[model samples]
Target: MKITEKTNEGLKREYGIVVPNEDIATKVAVKLEEIATKVSLPGFRPGKAPKDLIKKKYEEAVSSEVAEEEINKAVDQIIKEKSLKPAYRPDINVESYKFGTDLSFELSLEVIPEIEIKPFDNITLDKFVVEISDKEIDERIEFFANRQKEYKNSDSQGPVKTGDVVLIDFVGSTGGVEFKGGKGEDYDLEIGSNSFIPGFEDQLVGAKVGDIVDVNVDFPKEYHAKDLAGKPALFKVTVKAIREAVKVEINDEFAKKFGQESLESLKKMVRESISHDYEMSSKMALKKRLLDALSNEYDFEVPSKLKEMEFGAIWKQIEDAKAKGQLDEEDKDKSDEELKAEYQDIAERRVRLGILMAEIGEANQIKVEQKDLNKAIFEEASRYRGYEQQVIEQYTKNPRLIEGLKAPIFEEKVVDFIISKVKLNESKVSKEEALKKEEEANEPAKKKAAPKKKTKAKKEEE
Candidate 1:
């Protein structure tokens, strides 16, 4: 066998390999001998078939199998010689081949680039911190209490008003005919809630008790009921009673409704929840800054194939969104080439940062444990409400989705490790200021699927 370098550039390596015919013959003979022991022929006992007979019977099939093995070994040899890590499977180019001739081919591939790991001390970042204020906690509690507001019959028995609740009996019609789900009796409708069709509530603004009102409204074009969408309707509304609006007071009795022991306890829980939200915002802001800093500090060539793979995934999403008429406004009028060029940079950055984060995790031996995965699965399941157990069982039984959750978890751990190592200057900011800062810091990120990849054994994201 002979091997020679054909091309060596940046992260790409190409080589020409030639294998002697004798080697191919030897491999075919060995494979045929093994198959002969298991395969029976018309006139020969199993394991006792003559070599010439076996060659005649299985040579065509065995030769192809042997060729594949030789190609694999040749590629393995190239990787072994230089410890090459290919970004994807090497491309094999074989212009011609036959059973009794030298097997020659060109192997081309992009290698994973070598990344430099800068010292942790050299990276400096500002960590935003938000200190929760009593006012914020109070506001959160008030918002929660408002969700459970009560209403009572108005003492004045006057005309209905906006923000007031009304009891009504009504039948809705389109084109002088009543429609399905058109009638309600003693139904409580809030004037300003916008729960009913547009203009229905506003038209009931001056109705007194026992007054019958005809309300006209148009169902929204995007209304969920397709049959009624964009249609005009008239509702015969009867004002049964006027229910005045009421806001729940912050009291221990009110707190008990939510299972809290006292108003103070409820306020404490509200404060904790608000603090958690602010903390998450602060952490995200800090992480964005850290990622930006690390990306700025590193300069290395990423595997072109990997970048292309990432760009392909992003483009697929763009195409899908376009098909659904949900594409971003900025991308609405761009040519394919223009969109590709714009997103290709995003792809490259994603690949570069993905590689950098992976290298950092490897250098520090950061790992995602099974417990971490369990926690993530639990959190994911919680989002679906009542199907939590079913979701948990499904995720537990399906390793693929669980595996999908790992890259981000691992990236988060790497970020944590880097945060601990780097020089972090913590600055406390007001909740409003920190939120604005977070938005500003996060402005540049695409906030979508990144180029998450596992090298060698696993497939890169499509």
Candidate 2:
């Protein structure tokens, strides 16, 4: 057996392998001898068959199997001897193979690059400290009170007014032709709600019960129904009745309606909920600042394989959005060249940050506990509301599903670990300002989305 390097470049290796004819013959002979002992025939007893007979019947089958096993072993041995970690399975080129000829092949592969970790103490980052404000708590209380409001028939019922619910029957048409889904009976519409087409609800104001009136409205230019978008429609509306909402007294009885003991208890629950939201928002903002700082601190070329994988995932998402008719305005206008350049930059940044974060976590000996993974999974499952138990049970039964739950948790832990070692300066900002900063940071990437090539299948459905 002989092995020679064909090429050695950055993160890539190729080699030529050759097994001499002598070795092939040696292996074939051994296989033939083993088969000879076990051979049986119609005219001969078991273990009494000749070598010539075995070779004639089973030589081709045994030789092929032996060659396959030898090639696999040779490939594994070469990788082990070179201390190579392939990013993907090797591409094998079988140059030649036969019973009495030399077996030759080429193997080409990309290797996982070695990571050089930097010290954590040198990194610096900013940490946001957001205090839960009293105004926020009051706003939450007002929202809860609105949810508890009750509706009653209006006392002054001469005409329906804003904030009143009107029960009506109506048929609508555009250009004197009735459209599909344009007719309904006894529809309860809330005036001033803006739930219908623009100007539809406003025109219903000051209308008396049993009064049939024609209401005109223009459908929005971006209406989901393509046939009716930007079209003028007139509805023959008859107001049958009118009702108004009355705010419920925020006392113990109102609190008990939601399964709470008292109004004070309900208020306490709302405050806690608001506090939790603030805590989560602050933590996320702090993480972003920390990551940005770390990225600026370290300098290294990210592995191209990592960048390609990330880019592929992002491109898949873009394609899916285009399929759903949810492509953003900027995406609809982008050329292929512009989108590729933008997405390529995003891929490089993500890969570089990911590798840097992993290095920091490994150097610091950071670890994610089983409890943390389980808690994250449970929290995610709870988002499904009533199906939480079933989701939990399903994940618990599959190890791969549990791993899917743990990857993001582990990534976040690594990020947090880096944040802990960095010098973090606290800065306080208003909610609106922080949101604006986040949006500004995302603007550049948002403007470069690629206009996907529309598929015939998608167009047919549309």
Candidate 3:
């Protein structure tokens, strides 16, 4: 076997490899001998086939298998000898291959870039701290109370209005023909909820009890029901009752309903929940700043193969969004070429940042513990409610999904490790202020105009 470097540019490496015919012939012969010990022929007992007959029968199969095995072995040797970390599978182009002839091939691949670990301690980041106010906790408690609020028949003898829950029997039709699932009896619908088809609830606004009215609406183009989508329908509605919501008092009884020991305990839990949310938001903002800082500090070349793969993934998501008519508002006006160019740059940045994060994790020995992974798996499974076991089984069956879960866990662990090392200046701010700052930070930076030099006359006048 012989190997020679064909090209070496940045992270890309190409090699030309040649394997002597004898090596391949020997491999084929060994494979044929192995097969002879198991295979049976028409006129021979099992394990008693003639060697030439076995070779004649399985020569092509054995030859192809041998070629693949040899190529893999050669590639492995090259990788080991060069200490190369490939970003993706190396592309093997067969240059020459025939039975009893030398096997020649070109191996091309992009190797992972060597990233230098920057000093995390040198990076300074501002950590926004939002204190969970008593007002916020009270608001959250009120939110839970609202969910438990009761509804009773309205006292007023008038038409329905927003915030009123109306009980009605209705039959919906398109083109004067009723459709399946278009009829409901005594359904409770909140006037302003927008739960039904667009314009359906609005048409019922002035309807009074015992009033028979026709509510007209058009199904959205993207409606879940394919048959009813984009169709205009008229619902013959018979309003049965009108009810107004009565707010539930946030007392010990209300707390007991939620399985809490007392109202104070419920408020404590709500405060803790709100605090946790704010803390998570703060951590996220800090992590973004850390990553942006790291990206600025390190400008190493990323493997083109990885960049291309990332770009492909981003483009695929964009295409999917476009197909569903959910394309980003900012991206809607951009041409395909413009979007591609913009997202390609984003993909490159992501790949570079990923490489940096991995390198940092490696340097710091950051790891995602099995217990943490189990917790993540359990949390993911819990999202499916009754189908938790099925979700768990699906994830367990798909190693790729498990890895997808692990990647974020591992990345977060690395980010935490970096955060521990960095100097975080805590700045206390209101939740609104913190959120406003986050929004501004995430917005794209506008290019600043160069300051105009004051003319001599203007300066003299001033």
lDDT of 3 by residue, 1-462 (tens): 999998999998999999999999998888888899999899999999888889889998899989999999999999999999888899999998988899999999998888767677899999998977888888888888887877787766558888789988999999999999999996888889988887888888877888999988889998889999999999999988897778787899999997899999998888888888888878877877777777678889998878888777767777777787767676789899997887677777778878888888887888888788788989999988999999888978998888888888988888888899999899889988998998786564211111112211000000
Give the distance in Å from residue 107's predicted Cα in candidate 2 to where it truly belongs.
2.4
Error of 1 at 159 (Å): 4.8
RMSD values for the candidates in order, in angstroms, are: 5.3, 6.7, 8.0
Candidate 2 to truth, TM: 0.73
User: How does candidate 1 score on lDDT?
Assistant: 0.83
Q: What tens digits encode model 2's per-residue C-alpha lDDT throughout 327-370?
A: 65655788867766767876676666766666666667877788
Model 3, global lDDT: 0.83
Over 4 Å off, model 2: 20-72, 98-100, 156-163, 167-188, 192-207, 210-240, 257-260, 316-334, 362-369, 397-400, 436-462
Error of 3 at 112 (Å): 1.3
For candidate 2, the per-residue lDDT at 109 reads 81
- Give the Cα error of residue 353 in candidate 1, in Å: 0.9
lDDT of the structure predicted as candidate 2: 0.74
lDDT of 1 by residue, 59-124 (tens): 988888887888899999999997998888999998567888888989999988888798988988
**Local distance difference test, per candidate?**
0.83, 0.74, 0.83
Lowest lDDT 10-mer window, candidate 1? 453-462
Question: Of the candidates shown, which would achieve the greatest TM-score relative to the real structure?
Answer: 3
